[model samples]
Target: MVNKKPSSQPYNLLPEAAQTLLALMHAQGEVARLSEREQLFSSLLDSVNAVLWAFDWESRQVLYVSPAYERIFGRPAGLLLADFNEWRDSIYPDDLDYAERSLAEVLVKGAVEDREYRIIAADGKIRWLSDKCFINQQTDNNQRVIIVGMAEDITEKKQLEGELQRLATTDALTQSSNRRHFFDCAHHAFATARLDQAPLTFLLLDIDDFKQINDTYGHQEGDYVLQRIADTGKAVLRRGDLFGRIGGEEFAAVFPGCTPQIAQQIAERLQREIQRLSFSHEHQTFGVTVSQGLTGITDADESLDSLFARADAAMYQAKRQGKNQIVSG
Candidate 1:
């Protein structure tokens, strides 16, 4: 019997050659499809503006980061993939704790959709981000935990919100708190003072003969006078005190934790500041005076409205007796 060596060429192995060739062809086709799929995904990731990332929870490793990561974060994606701490380092110092803690919550909650935070970019500019993250549980029966997230820049949205808030709460002409915002704040302070039995003072001021000034100097000069008086009030008020423009020529201030004596002194200083502000129009320089009504918290005072009423009466009394003076109610 002749013992022949097995043929090295696959085709010579007649019995199994067909199966082997078919398997090889199928594998080649699958490889090509996989390559095309990967390229398609890479293109899609790069086209977007949000940063997409995947992390391995068990090893604390960054498994993948999309091209948008570098563009949005202003840092190299390679650094983040190499060390997860690079992502953590980019978070704003004040938001670092909340960012980390909220991310960890995804493990229990399965998803976190409303995570918004601030980050310091490579250029030393602050950018706001709305980051959403979720746990990937479809692989291997969740034996290994993975986190997937997309972070989008929302700086413009945040800025718009801030501007809208300022517009709503601020007086455009004088740059002071508007009437509504002032009353809201004063009401809150009044409640707090009543609860704590703390001292609080309220001052109501009106420009002396403001209508006459407008008639004599024109509305533009009247506006200038209003701005200067507002500036004086802002300068003279102590920190934690609230000042606002409540009417055309009327401003109100709330001095939290102030005694009657201290509030009187503050009002006097504000009057002096206004007197020093001299405005020239049509070859004549004129100064302004503010008639102020000062009132302090009393056991009989039930609400901020009561304080305002007494202050209002005292201010009218100052006007009648002779303007440019402070009357305590």
Candidate 2:
């Protein structure tokens, strides 16, 4: 049996001119292939909305960044190319630790990481970004560990979520906390007050002759009156006070670390503030007042309902005693 191997010819075996032409053609073909590959990579990255970036972990230097970085981060690519600190400095101080911890996780554990954080852009505006990144271990003689990552601008999505949360927890009529949110805050305040044995005051107010006002002035005017009452009450309340419209024409306020006497004084001032609001109907101008009931947290055993009921009774007492006054329970 005869064994035959593949034939081979060296370029030197050819004429000099022919060899040069062959080498030139081969080089041209290689160039064309590289050009095609570069075009494909550019097209793929250009179509993606996210920022693509790579860096050497050891040197802490950025090797490459896609064009989207300029568009999304609002900074020139040359800035990131020159120094990675420029990108690091753009992170919001509050979120800097969070971003660093994510990077540490990837570096130490050799894992992919996804994190959301805020950055101050070149435009002096805050932006939210969702970053997904991974570290590629050393795979070459240079022992270079590369970090590749992508980040997408999520500022608009975060804003939308915040709006939804506000709508869920806020009263539409007066822009005050809604019933559920009020109780949520009140419960937390109650727990804290109990733990510290601090005096927590609660105030409940009802619009005087609210139903009659609605019947006489129409719902729109009634709404305006309620709005005015809420605005006035909020203005008179202190900074730490929590005010909420727990019911129609009825509102509740909680003052942590306040005495019943001081709460009553604040309520009286709120009543006066309400009386100052001028409302005109047809040709008549009139002002309305609120009847307030105030109470302080007596003990840990008292539930929110019981304490609120006491305040409600005092408010009705105010209604019976002259219609517009502040009464302490």
Candidate 3:
């Protein structure tokens, strides 16, 4: 009975306490690993150049959006996530209807891949996007319908395609339609006129003694004259009229739904405009004139070639008559 029984020190833990402590340590380690994995996934999304998004269709709420949303759209991701209308408002006014309709189509079609449209960014710059979307047909545990999509910035690609089209269809020196493109359009117009039984006029014009000017003032000055004449033609022609430089010193025009009398009036206007243009080379000042041949579509005409032949012959007639006049065929 020393009565030292159960010393004042706390008692040691039982076997059950040790097991609980080890279990708690294991859970903490797992949580740390999960957090690191989550961070890695988010970093990957931020590096991408396209916007990836997930939406809860039933709730009309944005579920998630990648970091690229801010860069391409020039708007904050938080704003878009808070209000889906932020996206609808960014669409170009003219394309808004099509963009919304096409997006809705994804619900029925399962996926949409060819959805290209324009958007006005926050910075007031216009951008083009090739947005593709897919619908997950199955509902989640919460009965939420989700729509997933990716939008890529294709503005540079669109611009390159436009430039290539211009190079293919336009003359570099005069900035007018080239011969090949002009004939292509003219052929289409001729067929339409024939089918609709509409009146169409064709005019062929040649600069008077253009070679003499080129030889006198050199090719550079000759190019300047050609450019000015082309500009005048563009300015005088009706909106629907097609004008082009068809040869070195020859240009042509097609007037759809125009009678020969009205076409003559337009030709006279073009003539006056050209006459008003004066050029100087060295110490000499001079002016140039044009000889034109006019023809109209006829019941017997079979193709554009017939119209071309008549107009060419008539143009030569103008050349023979005076060199500065119009001849009708």
Candidate 4:
């Protein structure tokens, strides 16, 4: 866990950011005090996992770099000090335009700046950096302005955020897309199909006699059956097809650029694959089959709800005709 600094209020004291900037602000005379303050800032920054530096805004020349450069950027401090290209080259190419624009905003407004971007370190490993900056001081000549900032390594934080997002979007048991994420993907796929005038197939699959399975084998085994069904259906679906467990004992798929004939063939293959799965529960070997409702994008299909309603109607038709069968609309 991260530690928080003490929040005690002082008499007529400035905020944390203002205090930091005040310490960094340059003044005429008091050379000894300035040197001591510089040493204090350098020491404090060195103790933390951040690279503190300053540069000329106009000339883009490196003015100062802290020792932490070696640990974070995987290079010696002298390298960054030697040439501006070293710093420029480390920035990810795709993020360059945005970084420049953000910095330009900072220069114009003199407001504090913060941005997150990727960097390629000297070791050739990609890293995430949270860079922060503000104008520390401007020269009396106005030819050059001092920009001060620190870069913090945020790769681990970014990875954790990504994992959290995956967990939120994924079904825990079946390891497929959850209901919310399924619709999010389907909406995008729906727009693309409409624009390109492409054939898009939708499948609503339901397990036959799912409640009976739970009654006989228990909920744990019923979950296993559902997993097997999802696995089987995914194997039969084409690449780029969207598959998700929308409900208990029910799954859905969106197949873009696939015809109804091909969708029916894949549904048949999925049924066969489920039939091939056998589970030994309470010393009894048994299998389960699925019923599917298939539908394609039509000229009359104005919304996802309409398309899903058509497929859902066909799925119920399959259930009415027989437990294990395919109904197309």
Task: Note the Cα lDDT for every prediction shown.
Answer: 0.93, 0.88, 0.93, 0.85
For residue 149, model 4's alpha carbon misses the true position, in angstroms, by 2.7
Clashing residue pairs in candidate 2 are: none
Q: lDDT at 251 for candidate 4? A: 94
In the range 177-227, model 3's lDDT, one tens digit per residue, is: 999999999999999999999999999999999999999999999999999
Clash pairs (backbone) in predicted model 1: none
Query: Which runs of model 4 end up more than 4 angstroms from their true locations?
Result: 1-39, 57-60, 88-114, 120-126, 134-142
TM-score of every model versus the real structure: 0.87, 0.87, 0.90, 0.75
- Name the better of 3 and 4 by TM-score: 3
The best candidate in terms of TM-score: 3
Candidate 4 structure quality by residue, lDDT tens digits, 1-329 = 99999887663497788876666664434677888899998788778887788988778888888777788778877878889788778888998787778776777777555688888888988888888888766557775678888888899999999999999999999888999999899988988999999998998999989999999999999999888887776788888999999998889999999889988888888878888899999789998878889999988888778778888999989899987888998
Higher-scoring candidate on TM-score, 2 or 4: 2
Stretches > 4 Å off in candidate 2: 1-30, 112-114, 139-144, 300-302
What's the CA error at residue 102 for candidate 3, in Å? 1.0
Question: Per-residue lDDT of 1-329 in model 2, one digit per residue for the tens?
Answer: 99998657677987899899999999999999999999999999888888888988888999999988887778999989999997899999999999988976888777655689999988989999999888887768998989888888899999999999999999999999999999999988978888898888889999888888888888999999988888887888999899999999999999999988888778878887788889999997878878888888986456677778889999999999998888888
